[model samples]
Target: MTNLLHAMLGKGLGGLEQVFLDYQPILEAWAAKRGGRCVGVVRNGGKVAAAQAGRTPPLIPMPAFTDWDPITLGAARAVVRANRPAIILSHGQRPARVFAKAAPAGVIQAVCVHKPSFDVTPGTHYLCVGQHLANLALERGAAADHVHVVQNAVRPPPVQAQPFAREDGPVKIVAAGRLHAKKGFDVLIRAVGKLRAWDVDVTCEIAGEGAERADLEALIKTLDLDPCVKLVGWTDDIAGFLATGDLFAFPSHQEGFPLTLLEAMAVGLPVVATEIDGPVEILDEGVTGRLVPDDDPDRLAEALGELISDRDTAQRLGAAARELVLTEYGPDELARRLEAALDGMLVNSKA
Candidate 1:
């Protein structure tokens, strides 16, 4: 039986962290059924503990290292030797770099890329969350045969008796992510300002906290959108928060298959996202949702305005998006795909 070790250096509840948590159960079950063992090695054990809330496949906390430190690398090498894993699945650049160095001979090293950074060590197989990311990895010196496109997946939200009905009051729009420049919350605020200028009764609420909170708040104030737009920080129940909204907006400048966008679509919310690599791959133009030019607040506002004014279009798009996610990106389907990729890597390592 093949022993597998998963390593991630995470400090907060970002998309990569969420993927680590979500994939744990599936990977654990797969290992168990095959009479194998799965172990997780993470940095900042307390942060993962809070995010996981006492989950299975017990995590081993390793000392955090900014760069390649001998002590840290030696300790990681000890863990890999002890486990004697056939495969080491790494998440993020730091973990991949460390694990690639620590992994013993004949152990397959696979790195799951969740963002734009392609600083993976040489000879590491790439498991990308989207096709664009995989392409980027190949462009950045990764072998084509080593790159695998494994898109992120989400469990379908519980079915509501009826679709969400837009109330007669303000159109409620919700966006969630780390409050940073990459997320483009400032552009979203500007888009809301444009909507308000057109006298559209809309309320925009953004969730999650980050380094850009102060700047985003200041931007909100400068736009005088205090009454209509709010920065609701660090929500635990994203689905519940999304349930209360009628539409979702994502104005990110960069991403590698954003899980929040998947969550929004799963919850049956029509989306208006920037035409970036991640969102464009998931959203069908004029079908599932609207995709406007990145960094263009006016175009974003126009798309949002169309969805807000036309209730029928919003409902249609939301429902279509939900169905698409359910059929194509279900957890079980994605898990099988991941398992297949791991199996292929193991076979290739032997070859």
Candidate 2:
């Protein structure tokens, strides 16, 4: 029986925060079986914490931007001493730095890093989300044996039904994620304009909200994509939105285990995504989905056009994509993988 901690101080409920929140219930149940419990240290009044209200694996709110404050450090140290968790799993840059200072001797300190960072806390094991990220950790001076690659996982949608035969209409393309530049919504907008110029009837909706919303909206208007492309804002009913989409588009310039692609594919939505690492890993060339060059509007539009033209082929690909998610990326598989990694980390820490 051992206590476990998952500390996340991420500011908003982006992919990082979503993973943190989703894992709590699973981790809590994991510890419960061993007569222990899971605990979280999150930013005070943050969206993740607010969303975790009335949920299991209770939270301890921590002050923001006080990574080195004596009181903050002492408080975190006190929590560690009181909980005596066998493992401290910190997510995000700030949590890693803050907890490294508070972690006592004999505790296994591990960081689940999805993106590259130069920070390497001594004695901390890295659970990177991809080989690329694992390589980055090695370059950043992490111990070779201590770094482990654990890919992200997604739960299948609540229900799966084969898409119905479509009547002729504009192909509804749906893309989701924060409206940041890295998400490449501007590129996606341009792709839509290209599609229109090529006489491929299509409409697009981008879900999620961010600081880049204004810029994206301005670009949409400038391209005169009125009533054709839209920013749908952040959505809780992601599956429902995906259901309405005839095609899913992911145009990110970069990614590290993007949940958007998995979520879209899980619902049998034929995808057209940039040829980034995340999409490459999730999609099969000419099989489950279409892959286009990163940030290239023409290529993105071309791929979308192909799928839009061949409805039968697109449906077949969506079916294959759905099967891929069901067979390989289930939550059970993730839990098993995590158990093994945590066990290995514990053994190595004690050895």
Candidate 3:
């Protein structure tokens, strides 16, 4: 049996945590049924310590070094010795580089690559989050055979779609993710402000928390968006909050198979996202959602305004988005693919 470690690249909260945390139950259940144990691993134990202090029994605490120090490396090596894991699946570029250098020999190191990085080695097999990631890896000199595109999977919320009538004022849009610079919340706020100028009634609820919250709020205030935009903080009940919105807008500068986008699509919400690596792979532009240039607020606003004005068209797009999830992104199917990948890697290791 294999033991899985959800390693983090940084000490702070981010998408890697959200992606794995959201799917932790499904992965753990699958592993248990297969006689394997899956657990979360955080460096310095900040998140895990908080979780444990709250009496969250399921989250396991492992010694992790935040800055790739010798102590952290030694601790991770000790874990490899004690557990004798058939493979080490590490997320983010930093951990990927660390495990490649320090993990025990022949441990079948698998690095989950989601963004641009210059540190990866040829020996480490890359589990890319999407085709876009795979392409980027190959372009960066990673072995083609060593790269595998695995679309992220999340348990779809059991949603009962309620009919939403177009409001007289702004269209209710929800942008969910950690408030980071890369998330492009600044661009999104500007676009919303643009839409307001066009006299298109639109209100956006930006969810999740991070260091950028203050700056984002300041931008909203400067743009005079208090009446039209709301920065709703982190919530576990994202699905419930999304249910009240007419659309989802993610203007991230880059991503690797964003689970939030996948979740929104699963809930039958229309999206207006940037023409970035990850979104291009999942969203069928102009069909299920509209794709605007990376940082062009005007174009993004234009796309959103178009959908806002045409209720029937937006609903049709949203319905199609949900159908895409049912066909291409089922949880069970993802589990099967992961099982196959793990089995193949283990068998090849033996040979």
- The most accurate candidate by lDDT is 1
TM-scores for all predictions = 0.95, 0.95, 0.88
Tens-digit lDDT track of model 2 for 216-248: 889989999988998988889888888888889
lDDT of 2 at 32: 82
Estimate, for each residue in 1-351, the C-alpha lDDT of model 1 and write its tens digit: 878888888877678877887777777777777788888888855488655556564688887666489977987898898888888888887887788788867788888988886674567899999999998898899887788988899887764212346457788889999988889989999999999999999999999999999999899999999999998887778887887788899999998898899888888889899999998899998899999998999999999998887878888999998888889888987898788887778777777
| Residue 304 displacement (Å), model 1 | 0.7
Candidate 2: 10-residue stretch with minimal lDDT = 159-168
lDDT of residue 217 for candidate 1 = 89
Task: Name the weakest run of 10 consecutive residues (lDDT summed) in model 1.
Answer: 158-167
Q: What C-alpha lDDT do the candidate models reach, one value each?
A: 0.84, 0.83, 0.75
**What does the lDDT read for residue 112 in candidate 1?**
90
Candidate 1 stretches with Cα past 4 Å from truth are 159-167
1-351, model 3: which lDDT tens digit per residue?
A: 766655564565566765555445655665677687766555655664464454443554555555467877776666666666656777776666665566667678777776766455766677777887788778888776677776787667788343246446557888899888999999999999998888877788998998999999999999999988898898877777777788889899978788888878888888899998888988898788889999999998988888877878888888888888877887776766666666666666676
